[model samples]
Target: MSGAHAPAVVFDAVTVRYADSPAPALRSASFVVEEGELAVVAGRTGAGKSTLLGAVNGTVPHFTGGHLSGRVTVAGLDTRTHRPRDLADVVGVVRQDPLAGFVTDTVEEELAYTLEQLAVAPTAMRRRVEEVLDVLGIADLRDAPLSDLSGGQQQRVAIGSVLTAGPRVLVLDEPTSALDPAGAEEVLATLSRLVHDLGLTVVVSEHRLERIVGLADHLLLVHDDGTVTDGEPAALLATAPLAPPVVHLGRWAGWDPLPLTVRAARREARDLRTALETSTPPPGPAVPAPPAAAPVLLEGLGISVRHGDVTAVDGIDLGLAGGEVVALMGRNGSGKSSLLWALHGTGPRSAGAVEVRAGDTTVDPSRESPAQRRRHVGLVPQSAGDLLYLATVDAECRQADHEARAPAGTARGHLDRLAPGIPGDRHPRDLSEGQRLALVVAVQLTAAPDVLLLDEPTRGLDYPAKEALTRLLRRLAEDGAAVLVATHDVEFAAGVADRAVVMAGGAVVADGRARDVLCDSPAFAPQVAKVLSPQRLLTVAEVRRAFAAPPSADGARDLGGAGGGAGGSAPYPVLGGRR
Candidate 1:
């Protein structure tokens, strides 16, 4: 925590253009970060966030074979003259992909790998690893196999590994995208402490603004057209043109100039406490869905899957009726992915019963070949966007349409609904994770399959994108497409699904109504469920209704309108000081 107050990094009109890419990924990006402060960088996917970060450590033109046109310096080191390893002494980078950080067999070994490369003494390495592990609160997982730990644990280990190297600044990209809420909170809180107490310069890119923006001292907003907007964290988030949802609400409500955090939103919620004089919530339209008649049925008896010697899924029973929205819920490595793959015949299925009814015929999922199941089942895998290798987003959708033999116009309609802004000639693979996800989902929807399976469909999505996807899924289900989603986002599952199924250690432990299964059941509830403690309140919208009083609940003055949960129940937790 002791050093001269150094300028951490500077970006001088930097731009990144790859050999294969026609245009620059980053269009003249410029920014700066000072030592011992938290700076948050945000953009819609593919808006040059990755390119800008890569430029900071000289990974832009070096690892990517791109044209770099400007000077970027990190911690007094000219990035142009330094390779990644050479800059390791000054700048630490935690990549967007947690998987990218893995190098050794065990978590402890991975942490040690960097220290040894830096040629630090063995004793010092040991002490630094322990310090980082204790600070990140993942000490128990230090001995665990790196691949066996959950995504959250792996991410913590990734950050801890770099922090242990004793760099002046830490640069992280989308650090919490793959983590559950609890894990995300843990990582953010740790970073906040490191910035305030340990005097580490922290720069992070994230889509979950509600949680992290408040903790930042500086904020950078990147527009799709390559504009970099920077200012004090409160000013950019709460009052800027592209302010996030909570920020917009806080600002419009005339809350103290700008409320950055959720707790601060509570203090500005006075308007919501009054009963509404006239205005009412817009009527939520009925989402689209398949026909009410035909349904896909997946009545399972037992199934198991083995990768080498490991059994990913073992002996499980499940049912999926037509026009049903069912969520396959579990933590990482709980066999959720294996189950979805088993149903689609993509993964090895040792033994099990999976009956999918299409009209008069009932097809056994395990007995069918990959090609055969592809005709009937539509699958959107976890990390599904990684598989895209196409030139144009339009071409990506066309591939599915061609396979489906559906109308060519159906593909266009889906594209319009999903990503109207995407150029027809834009490379699908070059897009950001969120943008690619939209393309993938839109393509799959064009296939018109009777049964749909979405694996972690919400990754990389902002609050609005998540809501849009939920609406799409509800529509698909109502149309009689049997939809099952494998996800770590349990709160999302509870909102969009009629039934919830929990998988742990490769088996279904709980299954029932969304609210009963997620909120009432002790073992099956998500972390936020325990905190909210309200019956069947699966979303922030549902919780907000408690604040919308018409005439008066206790003869209070009617307040016509307030944003989000302003009128709802008191924000405080009634039990155990949890919220």
Candidate 2:
């Protein structure tokens, strides 16, 4: 497509198939990204999105041992002839997991590692490293340990590390999945500035489409059949089933062009707001369990976690009841994961009483063995792959069956229920980010513990997969399992959580109903909530119901059922003790 200057990246009839795979990951994929353009690739989990991004930087066939055909070019360099290392000067690759890309301990060292490998001169390397550190706004973290930085900070460093190499084209896969709203904004802003000022050609694949939809110049949609539809974001989003809440609102309100950002939605919200004036919404679903003297699934009293001089989690008390779904929300390094690990009894716990109560049997996680603790409480780490070890999916399932004392094919059955299309014989590591998480979750569910804990579970899932997970969690809660999820996905929280807990600086700041806390909080509110502010609405479903209800003389609506507003104190609902 480039008449004079060559395109930044090109995929010419490229198809990639993994070893022993039934179908190709990507088939007949062809596209050209012009110089200084920003392209976003989107798709469902296991739908060949990552495979396509890998092709651009030459990591598909070379690093991943896949059968490759056709051709891929980056900055006029053919990827087929150049391995990822060979094309380091032309293309930069940052993975979904930022921790995996770190090779040095400190932020400054990590930025310089690439330049050192390329054997840049000392003076030039120093200048480049400083430039990138400032460019990504990580100069403050130059001497900080990579482990000490928060998830968002670490991600910025990862980007800066690759940036020091001065690659013309940058490819990132789900760069903002683990970040909080503010952190995600920072990353996206940096990318936008790079594209405009530095003239960097960027291709990023992200599941959280709302963050990037407004900034993208081109949209590449990869489908389950391994075909891609490239077009403008607005046109594609008009008909896309996996669109964000703002887009859905636009379709419902009949706006000429869908609003990709909250500001645009707000500007168009006046007419819809007037239509909803006299509408009264129906009642919300009743919480399944009534106040009863049920056994507590999990409890923590004065629990604390510390590393060196830093107290990650302070003295805190928390509990989870059977049939309760609670969302732990906070900014990065806010001790959500720390509290979860302490409750599961897998990580360090300096001081606290962590207990799991099931059918009159009380087990202290600190005193129980690994198997014993797992039987009562199951935890899926942020790195889901860490929990999977067997060679084949079938073998892993079989081993889980044996370990959990589950019936024959029980683990496999659960795996099928959670993620249906995964092959039993495929290796766990080879699966996509979403599929791998599904496998780990299914494995943990096989134990059928009274309490389930998940950390950032929706990192790489598409909208469809996220909806499935939401349904699955609801079902688990109905089955009397206490589900605690530590996530930054506000939309997922609104859909799944009945109660919301906000943590900050290792302390609980707010605990209330999902609607109130989510609607009231500024940073954690969903897009729809911001668009329809002052109404305390948390989801598009609410808006639909509000509009569908009968109109009254006053034109008022009340969508209430669960606990009241988010600003009350109810003694924090103790668990495992009394009803």
Best by TM-score: 2
Q: What local lDDT does model 2 show for residue 503?
A: 92
Q: lDDT tens digits, residues 324-417, model 1?
A: 7888887678888888888876667888867777557988755666445655677888776765777787777677667667787676677677
Clashes of 1: 12
Q: What is the C-alpha RMSD of each candidate to the true structure, in Å?
A: 7.2, 5.9
Candidate 2, residues 1-579, lDDT tens digits: the string is 332367898888888998877789888988888888889999877788888998888888898888989988887788777788888987888887788779889999999999999999999999999899878888888999998887778888888988999999999999999898888888899999899999999999998887888899988999877888888888998886667777877887778777888899999998776666556453333334435965578889998999789887999899898887899999998999999999988779989898899567778876877767777889988889888888999999998888888898988888788777677788888787777887888888888888999999888888767777777788898888999999999888887888888899988888777777888899989887898776667667677667656556666665544321111111111000000
Worst 10 residues of 1 by lDDT: 570-579
lDDT values, one for every candidate: 0.69, 0.81
Off by over 4 Å in 1: 1-4, 15-24, 27-30, 240-254, 257-260, 266-296, 303-315, 389-398, 407-413, 421-427, 490-495, 509-579
Residue 39 in candidate 1, Cα distance off native in Å: 1.9
